[model samples]
Target chain A: MANITTNPESAGGSLTARALREGFYAGIVSLGLFVLFVGLETTQNIRNELVLRQRWGLLLTFVLVAAVGRFLTVAYVRPWVAARKAAAVARVRDESAPDSFFKRNFNAIAIVALILYPILAMLIFGVQGSLKWVDNFGIQILIYVMLAWGLNIVVGLAGLLDLGYVAFYAVGAYSYALLSQHFGFSFWVLLPLAGILAAFWGMILGFPVLRLKGDYLAIVTLAFGEIIRLVLINWTEVTRGTFGISSIPKASVFGIWSFDVGAANNFAKVFGLPMSSAYYKVFLFYLILALALLTAYVTIRLRRMPVGRAWEALREDEIACRSLGINTVTTKLTAFSIGAMFGGFAGSFFAVRQGFVSPESFVFLESAIILSIVVLGGMGSLVGIAVAAAVMVGGTELLREMQFLKQIFGPDFTPELYRMLIFGLAMVIVMVWKPRGFVGSREPTAFLKERKAVSGSFTKEGHG
Target chain B: MAPETNTATDTMTNDPILKVEHLSMRFGGLMAINDLSFEAQRGEITALIGPNGAGKTTVFNCVTGFYKPTMGMISMRQASGKTFLLERMPDFEITRDAKVARTFQNIRLFTGLTVLENLLVAQHNTLMKASGYTILGLLGLPAYKNASAASIELAKHWLEKAHLIERADDPAGDLPYGAQRRLEIARAMCTGPEFLCLDEPAAGLNPRESLALNELLTGIRRDTGTSILLIEHDMSVVMEISDHVVVLEYGQKISDGTPDHVKNDPKVIAAYLGVEDEEVEEVIEEIEEIEEGGKH
Candidate 1:
């Protein structure tokens, strides 16, 4: 964050001097650390009747890199960055120029990639191997993508920071679990049922607390989430308490096709296909793919409607929204219900995918993860959230394959142990680097002949 | 559509479009407005002028249904031969049903949205209908598309009026302060309101901007046939555009007449140009005495 200023020459002079001072100070500090590190390790080796290890070369490497890196950063990197920023400002006048070919065609490319993802996965990993990649990475990330998209309608577009969105997910999962277990409702029958139930609960939870705003709203929504979890835990008779509902029926296409093990009506046999169970994973993959697209489609459509504009307006200024005749109560409630409905859809899929429902799956951590995806992606950005979800969820799942690290850190080293630790660190690094997410632009629902991206930085305070 | 039935008597006038009959508002121990009454005739700019904290904004809030009055009624007689109680309605209904729109003392445009979107949001009630409450719109239905196009047309028309058509796609926040003030009024006008309440429309405007505002307010009254209720401390704007003037002090109507009459009214001058507490008492006494003498 070296700010650009008018007098670049003078500023550059001062910057170099400061860099030299910093480098000198760092050099002294590095020398002290070097002696301490070498002396302590060497003394231990000497006491243990071993050769006193002298690692001067390694210490010198660290010292040189630190001093030279800081000097180079100040002398060259900072001024280069400042010059580039000035050039960008000059380029703003000629903004009628079209975006680069790749940037303009990015959406079309992304859609094509999504459509061909399954076949590509199959080709790369073969049939059986592709199932893990599809189910663990593709389906898993898409669920979060859908969750983030749903939450985008609330936190992103609507500007309501809903921390406890997982409550709706739990509501959907339990709805499908309970309804299927007791009433014998099929997946098709209960799928919409789960969504409706979650939506109703969203309204119930939203009504009382919609008046609260910002931190107050966040706190109340959080309490609502904890209440749902407590209800599930305490109301053991209905939800089976902490033990959870097990052996939940798998979801199928119209109840005729299922992925059950070697059943007479197994989907693999019914379709007269191969006996591989990867068929089910592939189907689940496509199922989630369809569902995620539906979520994105609905969100894009809603953003252009009066209701959607009302939500953005309310987000910008509540007082202004009321004066303009936008029914804030209706707008907020609709956002909550619709967002929760999508959460429910994803939740029901989660239940059938796992073939079980448990309180452990519907924890506060889950809500935090979904919310992180939305924030780390751009708020109200459909593609941003999808990319963020893939990076976060798929990346975490990818950690399981890092067994090669044992070569560096000994045979006992395991990478999975530090997954969350690394994830948290990465989040901090990213947020500090770019306070706004990757695509923090507010694209107006209605525009003239040309559509321009309005950076959120220019947006009024309360709205962002 | 409903037939106009003259209710219990409000002795202000026979045909004023917006009538505030003895409206009062109190917050905690503060009487923000006390028994204030005014009438804004159809297609005329009525100015509400007062010193700071005179509760002019409070009255606007009451008429717009942002604050329900503690006493009395605000009524609007729309062209449909229907009279709606403004105080009884909810905030949104005042705009959607009563067809009354307002701008704020401080500009409150949706700064994140484009200048065009702000106008579209003003026509939310109309487009929402064509959207069939969103289902048809989601399906990309023809009716919704036609309505959306129409709403954009309306937005463009207002942007042209505000001289901001070029910045239609620019974020509302990016506009200069003067342009933003004009955009606010234009956004309110896009609602197709019969009654427009502008709170300090010229609050922070420059000389040229203020002149433009005067012309815009006058044009709205003349061309659109929309009655404007303006609250302004800027006397130049008040003197230029207003057809009628009501002066408030201590949350009481101190002077009520034409701009010429109210400008020379000693009580209004004493209240605005600064007066001692003793002089204020005298002005109130003079007003009450004049009110009683007129009644007799």
Candidate 2:
């Protein structure tokens, strides 16, 4: 709409005037929004009474920044974008141009990079220094990538908005924790068991909500998540309440090699290497990388199957799907169970890696973060979700290592304090710039002579 | 009802592909369809013509199992003499088991899917069974691969028939209006339906496109021996293609006969032209005098 209103051929003077007016409006709006938060601060004086302190100068500075930012964006960025768009339109594009070497082998390159991530980190930061890099960044980002991919099947392909997806993750985690603790089951035995349990719960959630759609479905799923968390918190006899299950056994390589330092069959003993915690982190990293790849592989393969097509058809239009003899009930349920299955896999991995399970870890915020990763990565695109997970999860983790910021802010400012604020601002910018996420185009699951990417405009977000 | 003037070529009236008996559908206080009964003979194009709001689509909804009739039975007897009660079955089962396929008045294609994919979805039941309910398919088994290829072949056949072979890989939503309508019909054909019910297949088509649609429908009837029942306001299409016509007015069957018989029926004429109860007789006389004058 703004594109239509702003004429490219406007007089130079008028353009500047318009930009100034728009900048002033933006500044006024920002002032109104920020005055209470920035202009005044509440403090406890020596007598322990609340006192109000004036920060008008800081408020003015913020207001001036907003004004200048708006002015520069309107005057420079908009015109530059419009000119680039015009140039692109004027040029006759070569539709059949071959892709660059990097573009053609992007997936292979990414896989290779992921396979070598932990080893590369060790070479760069050495043993102790690389533990934080590998465990905190590599393992952390991969877990989110797996979770987001799982949720993508439900929300992206099936177009079912599941607000309480973390419930399934919790189910998987707790299933592994309790079953292994009580039954003395190995991590290998409980991994698939956890997935099956989560899928069963997915079906349990799927049955009653079959008749519901849109906002109604979202609300029910949200309530279901909260219910699971509350149960975990209050079920003290089984779950240990808020104390959580602690000192859970670490995962092993098919019961052959354990990650423990003192275990007789430790990975270091088997490999004839020196004892180091980095070995555990590296092993866990590879395990998660394999699991994440499995999720991607299954999802991609399923998209080409009949059930997968039916899921997408249900997303397109339920009435039409029914008309075509596609059973929507089974289609939707399959999406739910399959999506939950992956979440379960990731949750079990999380439990093993952290050596604990707790209801607090499976909060609604986890679901929101996973969902945002899917949305920000462009729904239904595997590679895009991985990139988004790295940027969001790894980006936030990177903030904790910003020791240089202490020098600039007089050793008082903590970059982590502004993490959420920065995360939110980045989200807003991305949504405005690329509403369909980074990779908007859809690759057809099955193609004939030549495969063509379906434009974002042709796809629907779906009502479910 | 007008006298039965069903074509001599299709005299097997005892064996109708579809039979709707005493079907009535009520929406709250509005009687959308009142005790409507009609039979579409095997291997013939049957047209249900009516003025707007005469409950033409409501009857279709009942037959397709989208709306269960308040009171009545819709029986579809396949060629093998197997009878399925469509009204009792669920919407998908109506298509899956009864082998009854339908197109909507407003086009409802899987717009995001490719044109070929839209057709493959209609063959979902067949391929699903061959895939061993997707277990074997997911494993990339040879049997499932062969079945998938066969399904694609069937889709390609229909795509060629619909003159949409060129756009098979494009998203269904990206096609032109006429192409989308034809794709819907093509998708319905992919279901291998014993009885096809199309609601306003030529609703927004121009004359040339309508002519092409006529050819497609006739070719389908000739080649596949699939029975067709359509509701259309385009008299040109109804007159040119349909073997029998059923006319409705205000939720009641006003006329039923061959196309020529229904075209000459005074009730159908008045229904389309909107004449008052008292003025109907006068208009009938005016139509008769005009016909006599043309004869002279």
Candidate 3:
């Protein structure tokens, strides 16, 4: 309801009084929230008895920080944004402006950059130093980008609230891990098999909950996720219980070249490069990037097809969809299975990357994270979800390297411990700032004369 | 006054395109419709007019396969002599296999989709086949490409017919109320239905819009030979375009005849005007006098 095109003069007139009121309210709210946690600390005495130590000074500083931040945001930042918005409104009076060269060619530029990332990192930081950037940041974020895009098919296009998408991811990972270990199958063979198995599971989940919509569907999916995790945990004869399957084989270049450090056909020896593990990390990074791009390409292509339009129509109005001769059953199932297939691909890549598959890796929290990435990125927008994954996943991974924080909070302080808190705060900020998400407008699947982006206000979130 | 005896069999002796015989729908203790029987002729607009709580929409639901009737049979015969017992078919098959499409009493366009896309969705079954269930389409085969182009052309044809070609690219939700209603009809037409059922198509339209709707419905009948069965409270629309009118009250038909015959029926006058038995004759005479004075 925050109107970006509001008159700037009125917005600027009440800055002081409104900011003071808002700041005062923020101070009170932060006081109430931080009272117990920041005001008191639990510590053990010499005799090992628990005691509550008061930290009133720390609490007061937190409250004042919150208040001042709120005050500055309201008085200065809001007015500046309002004025800028007004100027923008005047500049583009009736029609949207043409895209700049950078904006138009953004995808090409990003793809080129991603393709060169591992090589560039090795050139800049050497093999030993480039491993973390290639493996931890690049590979990890691409896996999530793929997973989020997969879930977007169900929750975004079809309007199905599937809270158990991690189940498919788990199925994919476990399929590769179990199959490779038991049958000695290569990663290349197991990847497509894993996707098929996961898609099968997706249809199985889709069948029973076909009649459900909205919150009811979400609850069932949440339970389904837990069920898959629990099955993996208890099926000791097959899944190895909580210990999981380890030493999962690494993926190769179509089973022809291996990235193994010591094999006869190893990548390093064949290419006459040094025997460093960085080559494997670089390989994994490219592999995941290719997988992510495949997901994006397939999704973009599907959006223009009839099945995809049917899914969207089913979302908009199921009754109307049926009345138009669309088979809702097939439409819903295709969305579920296709989405699960991508999750499966990402899962197999995950197993190959970590060399492990366990119930601990596929939790409800993981599903929530992937779903949030899809939502925060603007549900149906591939670019938005990818950017969201980078910011959220990469941001958390970056927290581990914040050794400079020890200078202020002492050597005992770990920024990694506050990753969840920072994540929660970021979600809140995004929701408040851009509720429709980073790229709220929808790109139409088909156009007659000209393609126009449908505004978020004109688009429905869908009922089921 | 005798419903079954007054059936509109005298006007057109040809087989009815749609026949609902002894149809009844019951929700718990309440009978929404009981022993309702009517026939809609091929390529003609048949109007179902009823007072409040007369189960007009419930009857439509049965005919459109939204709800299975509790008793009796509703059969639809296409031009090719292929007959479908609608009550036995699923809702989508009624539209797909039976070639029967419908618009809701409340507008139900895919609001998030563009005006053109709304029509494209109606052509989903055809394109889905041509796309080889998307395998061919994803590969961008020439077959799929041609199908896609033809579907868009069909959607454009409907858009032009509906007078919505100008706003074909805009989101359906952004259209005005009248435009949205027209878009819904355009979308339904894209399905290529032989029988189209409209539930309260003129419910909220202003007089001018209602007049425009009358033209669209009549034009569809004239050009496409698509029979229309519409439920309407707009007397002007019903009186102007409908070949036959069926009147209902308290889930029972009171009159069935040509529009003029039904309009002057004393029983219909009592049911619609809510007059007592003795006042029915007086009300009919008053209506005749008004018509005579207006004629001059």
Candidate 4:
């Protein structure tokens, strides 16, 4: 196949071999930097006493190693790789066929995988006590996935930059917390209410910035998020301020029994087995999974609908959208409101799960993380966003258990500090390697016959 | 003047669909459209031709609600005798309610979307109307499904009309420049608008594309009873296709007549020649001398 043509210039030559050579050189440089850092920290005792003021030698060693690693890669590895890429580009003079079968079938495979995953977990690990695996990895990932999909509606579908997505999440969580606590409403009752409340807030946010565009809109949304957080913090009478509202009701077993087995409740009586938190976890998993899938399904359906297409039209070209008779203001408002509604759903689920509502929970960093998930996953891509969240969030969480890395870097070394550095590096690499996204395809909302995924291609800057 | 009066009476008897009454749009100190008045009759191709930056697009934009004019009223009368104040309505309402549609100078297809999707998006309001905007419709109600099916069929119909059926699945961006221009017109047509305003439809089209575009515009006017207002630079396209021609110079109306009359107007000739008042006589003398030399 045509896959072997790595050197875009030399169609006949071994392009893969060149890529291998470049990868090998990069590995050697990284290894060399690691060794040098170890030597400096252990033997040479080089120190930077001024900067961090804690462990001078270790800090200096890290700094030097990072600098040298980056410098070597930029000076040698990057140029060498770019030259090969240039060669490869020349080889592929006749642009390849735009469609790929693999890309087209990606969603089909993803749907199958999503369906099979819980079943496999139940079969292998059993459904009894698998909270750690199911809740942490599966449910948590799906929550972020839902949020990413929601934000995708605004940023990807509508081309409206919103930095206060977490505000909706806060609204949902607070809605659930306050309503459930006050009225003793079940999860199902609170869920829709929370979504509505969040949508209301979304419309409220939409009205002010109806005419704003680009960075100005982004700043306004960002300030709006901060204002919401501040209000939650200052409103001690209702929200209880920073102390937060605790003992928020957890989702019961289909309104049958609570997880608590005191004089008040008993799930064991209904199921004929001892009640376990695992039931709650499993139930929560399915609940959130359904919600996430609901978000995805609605988004897909909407895209094929008039409003969805209008959003894309607005995103692509606002001026043209207006001329087409698409009410851009209403279109934008619908996008924001819908996106916030989903965020609210995820937030309420979170509040119910944690049994708490704290201002600290809904932070700018959470919004950044969610936005990063959307960006890293690729805009308007459902599967890509989920995968990005899994990699980013799950990877960071997985890093906490890396006890062996401590042995290599000595007792005091923590990998968490390097997480941001690694994330930054990954982002830079992703930008250089796949500028569009990992699963870069401008996915269509609806398909003609069978839904086919389109591979992402480079769009002109102004167009995107 | 008596003959002019007779022709004016005949034109007025046709009953103008779009009436602009002393529409004056000023941008600070500059008058973009100064006391501009015109009438576009029903089921006719009205050509608005002008030099670059001559307020041709400004008139289109103001009519289409992209820009709110500083002064005057734009009244568009439908076949049903329902009148819409174009300036008073919101942009979307103008399209959704008033049934006015438009195309841009630069072909603005949702490049990322497929050829069919672009047309389907234009039919958004119609589909929404069929669905009733309820949760049942969202959950794949039979009516919604039928409407969606009809939408795709309508999209395919327009795509075929535009000669882009073979490239239906292709991303609109991948199409050649001329194809994109035609696609933009097809998209506007999908909306089923009473009046379609085209801004520089033949700007960058090759001769063959221009001919094809002429056929499409004529076909639309003939078959659909859709009035067309076109702003174009291609003299061949305008001269061959336009029923009525409105000429603008320096953001002001210099000539308004049929294609034959506008073509023969001295002011129109002088504007196209880019000649001053003093040079007009000299140029005419030079042209006569050239004709005399050719004869000799």
TM-scores for the candidates? 0.89, 0.88, 0.88, 0.83
Which residues of candidate 1, in runs, are more than 4 Å off? A1-29, A40-97, A270-274, A460-464, B1-14, B275-296
Question: How well is each residue in B238-293 modelled by candidate 4, as lDDT tens digits?
Answer: 99988899999877889998888998888898788776566878989999999999
Prediction 4 TM-score vs. true: 0.83
Worst 10 residues of 4 chain A by lDDT: A455-464
Worst 10 residues of 2 chain B by lDDT: B1-10
lDDT per residue, candidate 3, A236-314, as tens digits?
A: 9999999999988888888778987667899889989888889889988989999999999999999999999998888
Q: After aligning candidate 1 to the native by TM-score, how far in Å is the CA of A292 from where it should be?
A: 0.6
lDDT values for all models: 0.86, 0.90, 0.91, 0.82
State residue A426's C-alpha deviation in candidate 2, in Å: 1.2
* TM-score between model 2 and native: 0.88
Q: What TM value does chain B of candidate 3 have?
A: 0.90
Off by over 4 Å in 4: A1-129, A263-265, A268-275, A446-455, A458-464, B1-13, B274-296
Q: Poorest 10 consecutive residues of model 1 chain A by lDDT?
A: A38-47
**lDDT at A328, model 4:** 77
lDDT winner between 1 and 4, please give it: 1
List candidate 3 stretches off by more than 4 Å: A1-79, A94-96, B1-13, B276-296
lDDT of 2 by residue, B121-167 (tens): 88889989988898888888898899889998899899899999999
Order candidates by DockQ, high to low.
3, 2, 1, 4
lDDT of 2 by residue, A396-422 (tens): 998888889999997889999988888
